[model samples]
Target: MVAREKLNQLKEKFGGAVQRADMPCNERLFVFVEASALKAVCQYLFRDLDARYVISIGMDDRPFSGKFMVAHDFAFDQDHLLCSVLTHLPADNPKVDSISDVVPAANWAEREIRDLVGIEPVGHRYLKRLVLPDGWPDGVHPLRKDFAWNQVPEGYDDTREFKFDEPPEGCTVVPFGPFHPTLDEPAHFRLYIEGEMVRGCEYRGFMVHRGIEKLAESVLTYNEIPMMAERICGICGCVHNVAYAQAVESAAAIKPPPRAEYIRTIMLEIERLHSHLLWVGLACHIVGFDTLFMQSWRIREPLMWIAEKISGNRKTYALCVIGGVRWDITAEVKGELRKVLDKLESEWTPVVAAVSKDKNIQKRTRGIGVADRALVKNAGLVGPVARSAGVNMDCRRDHPYAAYDRLDFDVITENGCDVWSRVLVRAKEVFESIKIIRQCLEKMEDGPLQLTIKDELPVGRIGLSSVEAPRGESHHFVITGENNRPRRWRVRAPTYQNLQAIPAMIKDQQLADMTISLGSIDPCFSCTDRMETIDLKSGATKVWTQEELLKLTRTKKT
Candidate 1:
């Protein structure tokens, strides 16, 4: 169940290098390797074992282990094995050989760990600031346990600007955001353009980094973190809530009742339904198709109302607790949910058919923002983005958290590997979500909504959970501690990996199509920054009219 043969193979090859190996659950394997052998162990898992890199977490554990701790996570989607390769470095010399060269998706996580935990990623290509702001002072390392949550370092400069690399020869520099019509949050993009074609792009983002993880580890109690995790992403609040609860449950080895598991599954699917519909509408609006945008929104409004009716709030359901769910699907609510699913299916079928045949839609999307399987493997992309590229990996089917094991549904995939395929995948998945919810309603039995724990949860245990968010996989890693709080909590959002592939997708693309290319990912950032005006050196710097964008898109071929 824990891939015993593979674990033994690793032991056979790297016998002494594997300091400790554990099977925490049937699906998870935790291997603590010698600090010097970290790279080789990761390479074996990522390249030889064909495991997909999930995330890397850095923690200051000098107090407990007398050393710094780093965790490199990988997902063997085919074998359903989720592995964490952890290693500890000496407290005085807290450094580890970089694995980013072997696992490209580990690039940002390594840099982010360096930025927050003060553990240097030696040999990392871009070891500069990632999660921290440019104005943040050097050596401050806010995530270190010694630093207070609200503490501000001395000599901090709020007005400091990021310095990007020089643009290529014959290419003009075009700044995309800090203020752009398409991005909601304050992320700046430096686009090097030569005659309307994008040569390369450099991103300086994380303006939306709210320190949610810090809050959970420092101040929040065991039962309270679920509520805080929900605020991490506005669109996927329930996904965060559920992931956090499950991580705790996994660490404490707490099993909720069958009915609670079913409720969690139902809520997740409901969230997916609304999220996919919202994405369809937004993608349509990005392509200058206002009619479809309005239509999609019209069809989705009822879902928002239904969510509020059941969860007491529309977005932050706050439905998940440590051991189980806070709310259950009552008989009346179940009946209403079925009716809504029926109407959603009825309305979405015609829209999908019309969009599938629309020449304008196809031209705008067919060849744009393509992420091939090779790029996906390198960047460790997940969810629909990976599925669109013919990479068959779904956390629901592979990882099977919540009530997914008891349910039956297709893991929707597309071979097209383009924006068009991504759209189609989400559209078809709406029907699958409806199916999942219907099954939950039919097979779920009556039981308590939550479990009562007689004692405090065991401390110093590791917990990991990955939920299939509408955008992609949302993963949470937890380390339990004393005083009713987790000592360390790390969250890896889907955008953490998917956003890395943007430069690859947008390379050699027409400048006019940049908005749609970015929109295809459905970034959690706010609606584009209004740039009705721009500096004179760059002419015609205004959000394009619908007609112009569509015409520009059609002129370009795949």
Candidate 2:
């Protein structure tokens, strides 16, 4: 009914511009609008309706619809609805009005669409190459259906380099990474510093773009993607696994059994516990508080062990299938899990108390890397980053899935809007995760682990899923197609949005605080770089040296 009301509101305002709409359920709304009106509809939803911008998706639908498709997803958090405004573009010249001017959060996404899908965002002010490598040939869109998964486009200029923007007047450029002591993965940030203060920054990441989405749409089947999806992030792999399964289920109107839902809830919270503890430890280490770093990891180890016991792997649980989960919480595992939670809470409480009162840590982080409510709104920051700024948005609470609706817990928030605030939020959230897991263990009922799919999934139905990763919201978009694969599967990790705010967050801050400032959002470059490489040979694995790897990357040849 609420969805219908919103649909009616759109129809009333836009009339014929709102060509058609689909209300798959009370929680999901899909509106097809004229390509010309896409920008206005997005503005109305984002500004007037106060919908939170999630992500934008570009699809090459020429084989099926003979037209390209673009979708901009927004979350009406208060209404518990996720709405996507989609429009068709002419296949020959796929272009859509750029909404980045009005929706500042869509800047990188629009650029990425232009880069990978070759769908130009008309009137976009800064259309730099966001996802593609410098050596990748221009005008060869890899995501297009015509592009094969293994095809290497000719004319890849290995000697080509990225053209970075010039620094502001009187600022000295300092290169932070492609490799740095603080970074866990390869991300280059050219910091523009003026008198020990950061004036601005230019980020050149996606060094590990793996082409996983292309594989999903072209090569992988429905169930195979879950395994590959888990690899999206080393830490949050299970989050992607569950999110992908949920997306497919959502698009096909297939619900996982209740017991499987509870299992998913448990696994997700388990992931949260480990991720938060790991992040808190790393945050401390970044700020020179090695004591808490070691202590936090000490408390986190048991959770990983329990996860392995429950799902067989330490990190990638391989837990989800299309309709349900692959793992279950048996009685013995449940009892062990409860004991682990009890010990974890007992050990973690004092650490949090000490850290809260530690003046040294506070002094270092209190005002470092501030992302206020305005930054959150414009950048579409999520999870602890948004929560720290007093933005009450959580996918678990706002857009419930799995057994989160059945489980009751607090959404921890902080008003500091800085690195210190993020610390407090993630610290406090550990307790909430423990509470959620315990509730799942208690309330989980006996039922089938998977639903029986008697027929192939219906084609061309869109699915969107948002799972709250420890760092932020992990969103996935899916369009079911023939050959048991998705027509287009787009994953937007939390880091994709959170990392965009780094320039603003670090601006005007002390140059020395850059590492902790970057660490505060718990940036995961692996999640953001969702591409991959493959080896088809049956011989022993051949490890490439740095020189060899560089040559391979530049050439893009087998």
Consecutive 10-residue window with the lowest summed lDDT within model 1 = 527-536
| Candidate 1 lDDT tens digits, 28-125 | 88888999999999999889988899999999887677789999998888788788889998887588899999998898889888888889999999
Candidate 2 deviant stretches above 4 angstroms? 532-558
lDDT of each: 0.86, 0.93
Q: Whole-model lDDT for model 1 versus the true structure? A: 0.86
For candidate 2, list the clashing residue pairs, or say none.
210-531, 210-532, 211-531, 211-532
Error in Å for residue 469 of model 1: 0.1
How displaced is residue 553 in candidate 2, in Å? 22
